[model samples]
Target chain A: QQPVQSPQAVILREGEDAVINCSSSKALYSVHWYRQKHGEAPVFLMILLKGGEQKGHDKISASFNEKKQQSSLYLTASQLSYSGTYFCGTYQGAQKLVFGQGTRLTINP
Target chain B: IAGITQAPTSQILAAGRRMTLRCTQDMRHNAMYWYRQDLGLGLRLIHYSNTAGTTGKGEVPDGYSVSRANTDDFPLTLASAVPSQTSVYFCASSDSWGRSLHFGNGTRLTVT
Candidate 1:
């Protein structure tokens, strides 16, 4: 099933912090976080498995809660390059991934 | 090496015409997927293949067909193109099911 993302859109100052949440109705096997800038392909940021493991990329970090079937992405000291659409993809025992509606994040100077 | 390559980076087709978007991966991944991205709709999976010669429908498979005759290629076809199908199509692959995916640049298709 497709996950639900919170705060469909957000605007932050260059140094501000933000958190994006992804929640699924079905049990999840893994959760992936991707960011897509205009006119570019979606790039993989990180993946969180169902065992409470966490991963980070630069100033971005993510946490997965297996029991709640939810995950959260944290972006600290946002930069202008962070402006883009963020998607959370969820996998539930299948070969295919279901992606969320996406969160459009804008970081301004 | 090209992780994944999608042909006709962009295309414009007549509403009733047939079109095919080609995708190839050199990573030797065991799984491949096709997805369409529309404004405000995020990315919706159209079809997927776990291995060569095996294909399965995804969330939005209507009006689209896919075949995986080999591990390196997966092409999506539209029998009769519709305006609603105009969007950016992405092809991705992973070593196995539920693994991290690597995506191609994408094909921007417009059904006029």
Candidate 2:
């Protein structure tokens, strides 16, 4: 099943912060975050594994809650380059990954 | 480094025509996947291969077929193209199921 994402769209200032959430009905062993620019493919950002702690890259961070079966992406001090469609792909012992509808984020100067 | 590559970056096909989207990965991953993305919709799985000879249907596999003849290649074929299949197709490979996957640039297919 496809995961659900909240805040279909979000607008942020250069120094603002935003959070995007992803949830799945089925138990998820891992959640992968990706960002896609216009007319381009989705690029892998980070992955949260089962029974593991959260991880981050630069100003981008994520948390995975196994009990809630959800993951959240945090964009701190958002930059203009952060503008893109963010997608969270969920995996649960399946050969294919299921992506969310995506959250369109636009960061302005 | 050549991670993953896809042929015919974009294509225009007539309805009812046969088309094949080729995908190749040099990472030697054990799992490969094909997905289609439509405007304002999430990426839907078309087909996937756990190994060289194993294939499985995905969320939206009715209009497509896939084959993993070797570890480095997983190609998707459309026996009969339709307007509904007009979308961006992406190929991905992972070391194992439920692991992080690397994606290709994607092929944009237009069915007229």
Candidate 3:
């Protein structure tokens, strides 16, 4: 089944912070985060594996709570380039990686 | 500059026509996936292939089929297209089981 994402949309100014959450009903083997700018393909951000440590890239970071089957993406000091639709894909067993409904984030100066 | 490439950037097809979307990656990833994105539905997995000569059904694979002929190409086929199949289709490749997925620009397919 597809995972659920919170805060369907969010708008913020530069230097602000935002959090997007993703939760699944079933056990997750790993969680993958991606960002897609308008009219472009989704770009890989980071991946959090079960029993693995939380990881981050530059100003964007993520945490995975294996017990709750939830993951959260954090964007601190958001920049204009951070404006895009964020998607979280859950990797359960059965060779499937299902994506969430997506969270649209906009940042302005 | 090596990455995934999708053909027929955008296409408009009539219902009942057979259509196939092309995808190729030069990274030689072991896995490839097909996903359809609607306005509100995000991206839904339509089909996937773990390796060449192997295929698997995804969540929404009823109207779609896939073939992994080689390590670099994985194409999605719709035997009988329908209006419901209209969406932006993306082709992604992953080196690991479900790790980093590099996506193509996507093909906007409209069936009417």
- Candidate 3, A1-109: lDDT as tens digits: 8999999999999999999999999987789999999999999999898784689899999999989989999999999999999999987554578899999999999
Write candidate 2's Cα lDDT for B1-112 as tens digits: 4999998899999999999999999998999999999988978888889989999988899989988888999999999999999999999898975457788999999999
**Whole-model lDDT values for every prediction:** 0.93, 0.90, 0.92
Candidate 1 lDDT tens digits, A28-100: 8789999999999899899998798888899999999989999999999999999999999987446878899
User: Lowest lDDT 10-mer window, candidate 3 chain A?
Assistant: A89-98
Cα error of candidate 1 at position A6, Å: 0.9
Query: How would you class the docking of model 1?
Result: high
State which candidate, 2 or 3, has the greater lDDT.
Answer: 3
lDDT sort, best first:
1, 3, 2
Can you list the residue pairs that collide in candidate 1? none
TM-score of 1: 0.97
Candidate 2 per-residue C-alpha lDDT over A27-104 given as tens digits, one digit per residue, 9 for 90 to 100: 878899999998888888999987746899999999998788999999999999999999999864566688999999
TM-score of each: 0.97, 0.96, 0.96
Question: Quality of candidate 2's docking, in CAPRI categories?
Answer: medium
How far off is residue B65 in model 3, in Å? 0.9
- Encode model 1's per-residue lDDT on B1-112: one tens digit a residue: 5799999899999999999999999989989999999998899999999999999989999999999999999999999999999999999999875568899999999999
